[model samples]
Target: MPTYRAPRGTRDLLPTETPTWTRLERLAADLAARYGYRRIETPLFEQTDVFERGIGEVTDVVEKELFRLAPRTEESESWVLRPEPTAGIVRAYVQHGMRTWPQPVKVTQTGPMFRYDRPQAGRYRQFWQFDVEAIGDPGPAVDAEIIELGTRFYREAGLDGVEVLLNSIGDAACRPAYVAELTAYYEPHRVALPAIERGRLDRNVLRLLDSKDPAMAGLNANAPRMTERLCADCAEHFAAVRAHLDALGVGYRLEPGLVRGLDYYTRTAFEFYLVGREGQQQAIGGGGRYDGLVELLGGRPTPAIGFGIGLDRLILALTETAQAVPSEAGPTAVVVGADPDDTIARLRVVTQLRAAGVGSRAELGRRKLGKQLEAAARDGAHFAVILGDELADGNVGLRDLPAGTQKVVALADLAREIERAHAAHRHGGGPD
Candidate 1:
């Protein structure tokens, strides 16, 4: 026999860990609904070109991190597990002709995403995210709305000192000139740059500004800021976004070099970072406007903005901040058989309690009454209904495990008796 464990980059969330995950998912879904965003689910995997075309072939996500699957036959299309949700979501929006339904269709989804990256403290090969997207709207107001949505999620999750870093990377009209100016600024430093940075300088100049290499930091810091080069329309859009944020009482800091990882993103890029932990790896969540993504995915040109909150990093943050992660409450009662042959009677009593709106379970086996009671207590059951010889007399024993007391009640009155005990306990009286 061989002992196997969860694969290198994944871990099983046992009974002890799942309640917190469920709570977070529900919180995200409920908050998104309140904002008028309907739920949308895309497949876990999609046609490879959906990402390659939307995220860009030059990007690391498509070039390196993608978990690409080979085609089953030469005529079959290739596929890959989604490394991010926006591209797939956009694919759905286009495929289903959502543009005809309504303008600026707001939608949200949460699920597992696969990325082939080095697994560290908060990063995982398989992780989960809550995504929100507002499509077919190019106005700055929706941009501000999505940003605030991310901030509110952090606040409601008990996180403190989260700061928003905002930037505008210019749209297609003005971005080429900015990229040209940026390429010129770094021309002299080309020899000093590393192989990867040098390649980025010539291929995707914007990415060099976001590089983590210490050697390129000095050159990147000296590079011209896109905010200074934004065309009139972009500058006005950026200002409007800021005004909306101020009006909503959401504060943010402007970052000149905040071009996000994706190629589809244009204008109004933003990220949520914890104060004193501003590393990219520490970013709680981030997204920006991708006005051209729908067209890139085969739909007519449509404007959209969205964000993804990495839930794995979020859970880690909750633990590190000492915020309480709530656990699932135990059953209200456990029904135990008082005799070896009383299994059927105990099942009936448990079912009756359930019908009366009691959360309950039954202890199976021919164990003695004392053992059964002990098992129920260990399971966090508040009370145990022991079906004894009293069943013939239309009565049974209700034992309060915490109080170490037992009382006899008519079988028909068992549910009412339990309800009253609960009411008494809630009112600060003993469950009698």
Candidate 2:
């Protein structure tokens, strides 16, 4: 028998590393809520057609990265491990009639997104995404607000050195013309294009504009710029979005070639990158306006714009910048030295602490007092309540590990004193 590890490209978020994820998720959810976005959870899997139609046929996500599953029984239907939540969320909106309730329904979600990608550094087969989507409104203000929300999320999470690169892909009114021009531009250089670039020339012309191969860079440079070909309405919408961003003091660089790798996106397309990270894969978070996503999923043509911040990549950037900090693990009050004779008394105290919303764990393994304290420290506990033969006599010992302070208090008042200390610590009152 051999010790097995996590499957390649997958990782186990152990206790020590869980705080980072927890803090990031909490910050994202809080920011989303502050922006009037409610939380919505969808299934881990959805119908295969939803992604195929929504993500675009020529995109790499659909053409290569999707995880398709066949039914076990003959009569069962086909399903796919959802590659993204936007399509499923749109499906739910249509199926449940969210359109009738209000205009511009704001929603956010945080979960694992499965993709059959070739696992590499900063890329995983199963990764978590904190996604936020605004449905129904087509106003440029909505786009600006979503981008601002994403900026706030990263700032709050302490992910510095991020830059927002923005662009407008125009709307259906102007995209077709640009496609034709782009196709013609690449026609002459078709022989010089990479295999993937050549394959995408007819089916997905926009992708050719962003090919990473050195040979295709020259061809891309000569291609038409999307901003110049924007329709009147799209041009006005994009101008308004830029104006709003300027008014709010949100810094962004105009990226003419930033037609995000998705079909549903229209008008505004933006990506937030961590500067000085790995080349090309420096994107920590990105999103854009998807005005036709809802309709594609069978709903009314509701407009939406949202972003999914990559938790892993953001943490990696934090690490690279040496800005990563150990998030405060919530207080864990340890009950030490539980004797068999006074087990009931010790259990009662533990239950009381827990009932009061304090995370109190009892020493069930019958370890020595020194070992118990060590265990508490290892578990990131700030304080330990020693309940031995001496303390069992109406008094409890409160050991503050960081301060090297010990005090004896009445058993009835122990929980209150510990809570007050925890509160003060939480409010930045103590040395540690």
Candidate 3:
């Protein structure tokens, strides 16, 4: 016999871990909705061009991380599981005839994403994210609003001190000259550069600066800062974004060399890192102003900005909060039957209770009544509706685990009785 396993780089999120994910997503959705952002969903797999065109064909995501699928037919273009949600969201924005809607159409989404990257701690091939996009409008104010909103998500999750590392790669007007300067600075030390990084230097020079490679650290640190070379318009936009964040009292550090690897990011690029992660900064989420993305993907010349929050790391950071709080983990009752032949009837009762909006578990075994009751208690079940020969009397035994008490309630009154017992339990009247 062999043990079947979930494919590498993926793991199941079991029932016990779901409450945390739910609470985090609910908070994100509520916060996004409060900002007038509506929920939007896109296909899990899309034409490869959706990402290739949006994020740039040379980027790591498209070059190496993509999980491309074979074309179903010759007429069909290739598809890939979404490595990130932004491209799909933007495609939806264009394909769904959103042009007639209000300007800067704000949308938020949370779902799984696939990336065939090496699995490490806090990184997975299949992961989930909370994504937000402000399409059709571009303003420093909205940029600040998005950054503040990202920070607020952490606060709402009961974790704070998330520091924002922000920078400006400038726009087309200034980035070209800056990239030339960056390339020149690195080209001299090309021998010192790792072969992989040297490849990025000639093509996307800024990517080398964003590298985590130990060898390139010195080259990047000594390179020129794009902030010093920003066009007047970009400079003003950056200033206004900072001013808006200041007005909102959001804290952020200006990192001149910090640039998102994605090519679409323009002017403002930022990442949110856990400041208190034991002195190690781990980015939880980040986004930037991509003013040219909408137009590049065939839409009218529209400006947009958005962010993607990594949910796996987020849940890890907020796990303690979930533990401290009491949540409705599982069902409150288990309909346990004493007779082996009572399985169907027991299940029927379970269904009836559930249909009436009372959640419960079902144990349809002929195990001893005491053993079934003990299992229910171990699961923290508040009630156990024990069915037996006495069920013929139009009554069922309802035992309150906390109170160590039991009562025979009429079948017709079972739902009402369960509600009353649970309410009492909530009101602190049930036994400890």
- All candidates: TM-score: 0.94, 0.91, 0.91
* Predicted structure 3, TM vs. truth: 0.91
The CA lDDT at 77 in model 3 is: 84
| Top candidate when judged by lDDT against the true structure | 1
Alpha-carbon deviation at 105 in model 3, angstroms? 0.6
TM-score of 2: 0.91
Q: Can you rank all candidates by lDDT, best first?
A: 1, 3, 2
lDDT of 2 by residue, 352-413 (tens): 88887888887666566788788887777888888866664788888887777989878888
What is the per-residue lDDT of model 1 for residues 48-149, given as tens digits with 9 covering 90 to 100? 899999999988888889988878899988999999999999999998999998788999999999988878878888999999999999979999989999
User: What are the clashing pairs of model 2?
Assistant: none
Better of 1 and 3 by TM-score: 1
- Clashing pairs for model 1 are none
What does the lDDT come to for candidate 2?
0.84
Runs with alpha carbons beyond 4 Å of true place in candidate 1? 213-217, 278-280, 427-432
Q: What is the lDDT of residue 161 in candidate 1?
A: 83
Q: Which has the greatest TM-score?
A: 1
Candidate 3, residue 235: lDDT:
95
Model 3 scores what on Cα lDDT?
A: 0.86
Error of 3 at 24 (Å): 2.0
Better of 1 and 2 by TM-score: 1
Give one digit per residue, the lDDT tens place, for model 3 in 204-306. Answer: 8887877878877776787788988899999999999999999999999998768787889999999999875753228889899898888888888788899
Q: What's the lDDT for residue 182 in model 1?
A: 89
